[model samples]
Target: MVWKDETKEIYTEEPKEENIFKKEYGNTDDEFTYIEKTKGRDGEVKETVKVSIGKVSRYLLTKFNFKTIFGSKTDKIYFYESGMYIPKGKTKIKTEVEYLLDNKCTTHIVNEIIEKIKRKTEIDEDLFETFSENNLDLIPLKNGVYSIKEEKLLDHSEENLFTFQIPINYNPKSKCELFEKFLDEVLYPEEIEVMKEWFGFHLYRRYFIKKGIILLGEKDTGKTTLLDILIGFIGEKNKTGMALQTIAGGSDFTKLSLKDKHANIHDDLSSKDLSDGGGFKIATGGGHISAEVKFGDYVQFVPFAKQSHATNKIPPNKDVDDMAYYSRWMPFQLDNVILKPNPYLKDEIISKELSGVLNMALEKLKYLLKKNKFSYIKTDEEVKVIMERSGNPLIAFVSDVLEESENGIITKEEMYQVYSEWAKNTENLRLSKEQLGRNLEKNCKFIIAKKGTQKQGRYWNNVNLKGNYSTFLTSKKVIYLQSKDDVSLLQYNKNKSVESDVKEPEETKEEEEKIEQVKIK
Candidate 1:
């Protein structure tokens, strides 16, 4: 076809078919190229274009910077943008490719380019985990990114595919008086310090200090507000809102929700007992998590989020005496209640004082980095109180029923019998006798030793029931045991030795034998 440039006062001819295809799309000579169309999709004359396979692949692979992660049942592609890489759905990418080609390429053609780009840009899945924790990719803020080792901002690079970002720009001198008032009114001085340090820990890639936080308080208390501040401080996109029950439930689907989240928030947490704490321990204890995407590949990554929970009632724990389990929790109970709550006050603080809060958290993080550990130390009494409030049945049982004395002694059988009865009467969950023995030794500091030659059993020394089980069994009369055959009640003589009664009737003897051989059902 011949075309004339009337405005230029010259006559020119359109390039031949083979010549046009040979011409590069831009000044650079690249494998991928594009060409203009003389007719529109409706067969009308118009200015439109269609892209080649190489052209579309190059555009997507360069413009969006898509990285393909393989080595799983299914291939996955993540596009880098906004200081992070986001998982892009295949269906969406196909649509985008079709648009660039003016819907000229078949589904097969589009798929071919997509797969070509992915294979050419394929990266080992392990690189995601390694690069995420690299010092240079530690913290990606809205204005700039930071390294965990320094406060200076590093130059932005596409190689750093950070998935999490602090929404606000870093302003070391930012201040908000309203946020200060809210914190002072809600948390004690020590609690505020702990809160700041905990928040600071969320901005990093690796968890140097692994501990979950729980805020205990009643309704209208500032517990939720305090945690909500953390949610705003780290932006909603960086947080995963899931309950402790779900996180510790051992469901891979639930576990997948924690990947790359800055915080796992459980606001208004339910009062469910934590039946399994293994998942919770791994989440806050810096162990790698293997979570599978539903109908997709399994992703293994170390969790970077800090868990924070706000609850009206502390949840019960199955592993209450497991020090390894309980040690991961840091509790702060909110005592102040905002009787007249301003609903918009939280929003106001986030909008005005969020940057200041970030700065405060940064200072706390710096302090922790200098010390190489968390500095907020809880008093012994505070620790005890927190343990007790966490629905620890042993603590309550020990306080209300047991006593410690230098000369006190009780057999394991007798102690278990008393504990079982006490648990039944108090409607508490009864632990196994063997577990009770371990708890006694670990918590009460009581010595466990084999009984004397008289019987084959073990006895707990220096710990006994405050009230004798004899009275607990019955209020009828004093009963004494002599030579393993004794009535239900127990009695000790002046020398604390067993002795028989003066008269031994046949029926009384039979009753004593039955009591001695009685079985617990």
Candidate 2:
């Protein structure tokens, strides 16, 4: 063999068959040659140990499936096991690698070997670009993953990175009678079907769709029980419990909690009105949300969690006319309280009926896909009424407490005073005087005009207080008017100038009937 050095060329004879054993026992110029020299008390060499760094590297590689995930700033080291790529700590990896060395080599040699092994195993991050939204049909289960759409078992791939596994296997024939009974007890028949679709949407990871479920009911109404069943179905570790108010406000930890979560369940929802719906809009609208790791930099990620909240008081929103926020909510009312609430009912349902529930969810998911939308028993008009009352305090106040006249005007100050008083009585948050004026013009088309006389301050046109609470209660000639598009100013008394053939909204009709019954009494 001939080789060129930096300064000269060297020639050497090729080894024969007799030299095969000699080549294996002795090393020539291989830098990976690991020789541990042990000395006697007299400082004389006692033994020469030959340690194969390649063997040690291979052993560590086989024992721990070390992988490097490339990042923009820094590479993350992880180990693959069960369908997850768990972050591997430097100290832990070093300790495992050291076990193979057994103190036979110097620290420098050990580190060199570890680095070489890492270089061999480290791969590009794009290689692991899997488990995307497109692959969400593959639901991870305890025994194995199953494709809900395909209705068949899927082979587990190394790219799968789900952290939690559902406890129950896919059983299409399974039936959950107890859970069905509980659903019937807590929700209307139509609502039960909506609940099925809700569960299936989460299972399918349909985060791209901008929708969420909100349940409103008083205490002991089985709201928590229903939410618990959902949490258990998704696996506790796969769900988060961030409050709706915090999420809407985009609190730092709220975004972090939602990462990798299949559902965000707020059983005890906050009663605070949602003044800021930006974060909520982004999350439910499939926009990338920023999450900051504890003591780390912020990272942008698309969250897959479906938000479900239950509250006694549905919080009012600042802007109900913003379809981006209100349209995302599918509200349902729960009134049937469990007479004798079973403490262990949730556990029983989860333990025995999860497989059945999964089957039902998949069935509904298919139906939702076919329909391209959710089928809700509660009409959109009904939901709009509930949202108006809970989302726009100004609209609710105008609808219930005020009346419009052919030629009427009320001072902005006086109207706000009356609104503030009514808000106090109704337990609604009153908007600021400035905000009230702006919203009145923008949403209600009621102009805030300056009076002809300089002394008379600005006043809203074409509307006035309905005398007093007593007069409002006794009024019978009132007629509700709204546009066909369901624009803002949900309800106000009809006048000659604003007449149309538009049918009255369901809520206004119901209120009118209630008032007629009061008059009859």
Candidate 3:
């Protein structure tokens, strides 16, 4: 009934929800839901509950000094692009705010979100850090089912399909069968263990293992197959498809591309590919390499993703002579190949077998984390091949010609002759007198020009197992060639041509042509 004195026009308007905030803030009872957990010492347990004041997101935003204006008309959160609060209305708001958040979309909201993110972060912060860190490479947890972005890996944790696509039916047995089958064909039986050790290295990368891998193989040697499985497990976006040279000789754009990669492969390279200058010294964290955004401040981070190079021909031995750099390079030889390319092999492994292999790798990662130190099992065959192809004939020559001098001393002249002969015989580049002197001094603390008490132009003194260039290779100070058989290190080097053993070291187009002609003849 309408009152005659009062003009009652039918009026409908939006309901006022101001009291919703008052209930959570001003009211105490019947507001908060209390959840409790017990914490005690000495076999005792206690329980406690907290009555929180407001919505977690809003409370956190204010707590972190991130003041966002609630858009009345749009029903969205708005924060200035400059990470500030003006407390002004939406109409005629200054240009400081990049734009208003649209309820229609979460896209292009990164700037607003970034304004809200506090410098101090906890577990969830790490999850959000994928954008800022540019470090998206996923590491497997001890539980065999956790992402590296997670700060905590609980015992009750389970594998996540979205993170690195670790499969549902991961069979370790099947993985072993596939890996064994693959490696058995590509490498010697003894060296398979080394290959296994290196394969598992990618999983426990948070340990900051600086080691990279060199996979040397002919076509169809299962190297690409292994990489295919890796790419399947790790989504393409989380890796670099760019060439190694692009990464090595970096620009602002190239540095940006280095982000988010797990295994950055420099596929199918030859010695000439890295001939002008090389990347290992910087890419392996040998030096502090700086990267930056275009027209932005420069920043540097230790790269976690391993830099792998897959090639048919081996890199020059001398180029890899620095033990500090070379020691981190794990080289595997895959000489044998499938004569007929079975395109389905990749499908079988990635679709059917890879998940199992991933689980197997996770198991190894668990063990590695528990061990806490690198106890990589070194295979004799792997060691032999790694040294021979390392581009420095000195290591091979030492293994062949040099004996453990009783006095632990040797003349520079004596050593030079050994290297010279090895160079001529192996058809490798020879170090000049100055370069040789520098290398001896840099690696072994042996000064070539400095003379000893005896009649000598240069002397290597204080030579011991622990204080030499090849000391890190094996436990023994004596070279393996000390044995009576005295087999040449050439047997370990696969790609070396016996007939054209005296080829020149210059990595020019003309030089490559000359070598090809010799091989043809």
Candidate 4:
């Protein structure tokens, strides 16, 4: 059978053989390809087509149909013919370009296609949704691509979905706020000033200041209460352990090893079993400790031993290695103070405020860490206040007196009074005078003693034996005197000695009167 073109009556023949496979070829001179159709065994004709010239096969199809099909007005087309019995039939054809870019469609239709392509090929819808909900502006690109402009997203003037600036007072009702409030209300102005100064110093220096603050006092002193408030303010992340039971064995030295999720709060440390020696250590380099652990048949030694009675004991005298470990920490003792909770705020409210403060501090700490700042110096006054607040009465008194008095100058009477009172109040104040004197010499550079005098014939003099007393008193000089009368000539014979001594010693009355008158004149 043959088919003729509608306009030109150009004919193409169909193949007669049942197994005939006709290959359609397009223009060899142009840059487009065409389709071919064949009748299959099921009495249905299957058609296949190509229109775009990407590879060489498609390029050859364009060359055949030069003027009519491959001309400027249209792309190339191919025709397949066979001289057989089957009839040639009309076929429906489509091209890739027409389906992809339908210019006749509206922008909404194009957008639908774009969205479908994005879902099928490129951008993740979940991420897009998240960004969108967060107020992020994301643009989809060709091939289902999405992009973000860094500058636009980071612009502070407009609120963006992904960006938020936490306000300083955002959580005013947080636990940290309560802590700050408590501190402000409870501490004296001077104490607050010192604490503020300390905070500033640490903040500016970017230091990891670990203060081993111990709160000591009687049961009613609010030690535990204060700690609870402090812990709440500092937040859970900042708190590592609450009343830690033990340190784990073979722990890393770079991080804290205490068990529990809160910071240590030994409510009544004095009442605790400290005989094992477990307590706070500060100012330790690396801020950690290592110990060996042995287990099972292999007895693999772990580096850090956790809290255990065996590990807490004071090392033996000859155990230099253990002593070195113990020397790395500074311990502070605290005395508890009684405080009544404010009736206005509920416990939950106070707790929330404290937590907020702690979180803020942690955030600040993280910021400081990024900047690589750590370590700070305390002013003398601040140091004194801290020492006093820690609850060592001796340290407190010393710090207080040091702040008030002139440097290196304490009156002897004042010293005596302070010492006498301290001795009377303090238990185990058994130091001998000599030991006390030595201690004074070492720490104070002064001598302590009672008054005494030395006698020389008719002269008695007070002796100042203070170690540096002579250095200050230069005018007083020591003098030595001897008797003028010689004892060797006084006695003579045994029998006549008494009479002879009497006769020589006697003075005439007139001589005595003349001596008296001369003495009076």
Candidate 5:
């Protein structure tokens, strides 16, 4: 026997044609028997080999063995296994067969197919190798879409938390210019200064004073309109934009849970009755409203109302938390008096200019947010500027002047004179007493005094008369004497030397004795 190199050469031999089976195995109990196809010379059984046919191997026999035996056109084979013979008929075997083959041969065929596929695919093993080396795990899904675990998502929760610090320095020049444009072009130029002053003061307090802005006024006084304009300038849909939630009548306050990093605009607040525990309390006081909410399973206390409104009265002795919430806002009342329409309300060109200015301010705010810098306009200088620009000197000054004036009525001319005096006296040049009164009277009847006295020496002695309380002099120079005779006593400045010359005469000794006796009764 000669041997060849095991790795290089395969032994080849001429194939011999031999009968696959010569068997006559019978199962008498099953009523099935295998018929012998070939016999020895003496017609006796020489060899008994069982040939098995399966669904798959039977096709191989028909295509290969039968073609080899008869002709290429032939398509039949005879085979038998376990007392069953398969011919080209309905009785042919259809069960799966296990072929006993050499393991090395089977492995060689599979490896060849895999190698072919790999070569055709041109798989980049280096790419996967680099990824594995770097310990980077990536999952590729259909198309370009992919997802990571929620925990693995980048953290934006920290970015969402916002704490607006006080004393925001609202630019007066910019605010004034914008407001002037709005006044002159949009709605009312006269109101421009008023709006500017209002926005300036509130924003200043909000940013510097750490107060919330509250506007109270009658319907159509442009409260909501002004708010809408502000919102428009700020870009309501932007990331740093304002959020408006209009409260209808009887709506629960729990709907006010505001998202972080957003400004809330509450509109139509007056519709809610504050007499009963209603929306007004929620706006003034923060609390949880328990009601059968449409979507909630049970009544849950949700923290809603964040601002206050005069339309809603705050409950007395509200929770401390609610009061604290209410204290955050800076409230202002809009004047009901109508003035010339603001230019911003009518002139589109000026309105656009104002909007551009407001947009610039918004950009500045964005920059501040990015830098993590919190600032506000808190100086008295800034406040004065706001007051002057807002055209609301009268409103700002009225309260102070009313307290200072001898009588509430200061003449119209006197009002202007006082304003001029105040302008010179104060750093802000706010309005004076008379000016404030005149301004108040433009909208409603307010207290104003005549110049000097109309009848300085006149006296009323006998009649006790009463009417709507008109302005009265409390000075001793203007006297009202009590006399039953209807006689007017004319007297000079007697007792000028007396230390307390203006004492009323007492008719009291007997009356006082009688009052002491009332206790005995």
Candidate 6:
């Protein structure tokens, strides 16, 4: 073969094959680098071309006479903070783009190339994705922890911190009236506030929210609709659907569902209706939990995103009075449901109100996130009652059978018997005496100490023996036990003074570092 030039210029000496391959492909170019033309089943020629993403990757190795000119010499992918892609890298491509603008390229052509890059950046897979809402490949959500790819939503706007890539959308009207309509669907006031907080959570990742929100009630009361709207804001790919156990569990497959996820939703929890909350607590609480990937070693990461679950029934809880468990829970109730609601309501919200709702939520998050505190309205009475009822039957059982006076005493055995009888009669309320004792110690209502004497070496509530049991209340005051078991607990008793052996739960190093790193100047 002979080498020729475009302007009819020809070389007297023919180019060697090795020199041609080396110069055109590279030193390590594959022997199969030649273009192959084969007819398909339909008799169409199948052309082979090598594609290179700026020498960063060359898996396909597609060939083009253009000679990979689309690839930028800059090492970094160029996507501005405002969800727009540029043809060059952040640092190196600027001068080149400037030179092209100053020389042969028109301003319009440069902008057109930018738009093309936005549509198809022709970058490596590690650099960009094919436009999935909040796709992880494009947007990195680790605010102060992992390597991040931060982007701005608008020019000169503050950079939005994201752990997952979200698709950018807009409101045609640029207003959120349907969002208010969505909020109106929630009949309760406290639940409305909770939804707002949830909105705040999704719009901003820096708040480091501690609690997770779950909607407890029958369907059609707007739980599904509210969650669907939130999902719309995050984009479909960034959101995942997994049972609570799957998310909180150590299983490699379940843990994989969480990788680069914006939300892990537990929608149909028909089987595991009662949650011991092992994984639930982990997802909402800011801390490190060990997880393993497929065929990979175990690694630890701070749980990202607020976990949201919806159930027609209350999920049972094992950790009673646990600050770690309770503090991480943001429970709400949706009453007076309208089952079989408008099926198209979710679509309407997504198309019309999602952007506005996001706008409203961001506005609210700017204020709520200022202190990095979740100071939202407490759960309503219905929400509280539902949480208590669903949490542990023993909570109510102990309060009902056991008295709290100085002289009044209910042994662990007695309380256990009462709980057992109650559990047997109820559907999902059975627990052993040993289990009862454990839960009792965790209860924040009353004291559990050695019954009046050591011979009775067992658990007892309201054990008032002069000053014998007084030492147990070392740091906290001993509220005079009430005689009436029916008295609604007005004040929550503090935890048993920290035992030297019992280690307090500490925040993860990631969260601690993030707090320090993101501190406002």
Number of the predicted model whose TM-score against the real structure is largest: 2
Worst 10 residues of 4 by lDDT: 473-482
lDDT of each model, Cα atoms only?
Answer: 0.67, 0.66, 0.46, 0.31, 0.32, 0.49
Candidate 1 lDDT over residue span 345-416, tens digit each = 788889888889877877788887787666557853555557564466676566655677778777788777
lDDT of 5 by residue, 1-521 (tens): 22222133433542222422234553222111123334332344543223322322434344321111122232222233222222332112222121222222244433333233223323232322233223211111111111122212122121111122111222324433443433332232223343443332322112222333545444444466566655443324311321223322333433424322123455544332223324434433334444433443233342222232332111121222244434443444443322323434423423444434433444443444344332333343433323223334343344333342232233444344444443443234555554454455542224433345564322112211112111111111222111111211111222331223234235323433332343132
Per-prediction tally of clashes:
0, 1, 6, 53, 39, 18
Better of 4 and 5 by TM-score: 4
lDDT-better candidate, 1 vs 3: 1
TM-score of each: 0.65, 0.66, 0.47, 0.33, 0.28, 0.50
Candidate 1 off by > 4 Å: 1-51, 89-92, 95-99, 103-106, 379-381, 390-521
The lDDT of model 1 is: 0.67
> Which ranges of candidate 5 are over 4 A from the true structure?
1-176, 180-211, 218-222, 234-294, 297-326, 342-521
Estimate, for each residue in 369-474, the C-alpha lDDT of model 2 and write its tens digit.
7787788755556666676755556666776666666577777777776666556545566789987877766545444455656667787777655544433322
What would the TM-score be for candidate 6 when compared with the true structure? 0.50
- Root-mean-square deviation (CA) per prediction: 15.8, 12.1, 17.4, 31.5, 30.3, 18.2
> On TM-score, who's better, 1 or 4?
1
Question: Per-residue alpha-carbon lDDT of model 6 for 1-521, expressed as tens digits?
Answer: 54543334566776554333221223224332334444332334445543222231121122110011132332234434333333234232334444433443455544444333334434343222223234322332212111123323322212432324445453323677756655654535435555675775665432177667777655456777777777877767767787765664447556656654567666645534434566766666655567664455454655565677887665655454455566666776555344235677778777766656655665566556565656555644434444666555655444333446665465666555545544543334577677767776665366656645676657565632222221221211111112111211111221222122122224333333332332221
Q: Model 6 segments beyond 4 Å from truth? A: 1-152, 155-164, 170-173, 270-278, 295-299, 379-385, 391-521
Query: Per-residue error at 170 for model 1, in Å?
Result: 1.6
Poorest 10 consecutive residues of model 2 by lDDT? 475-484
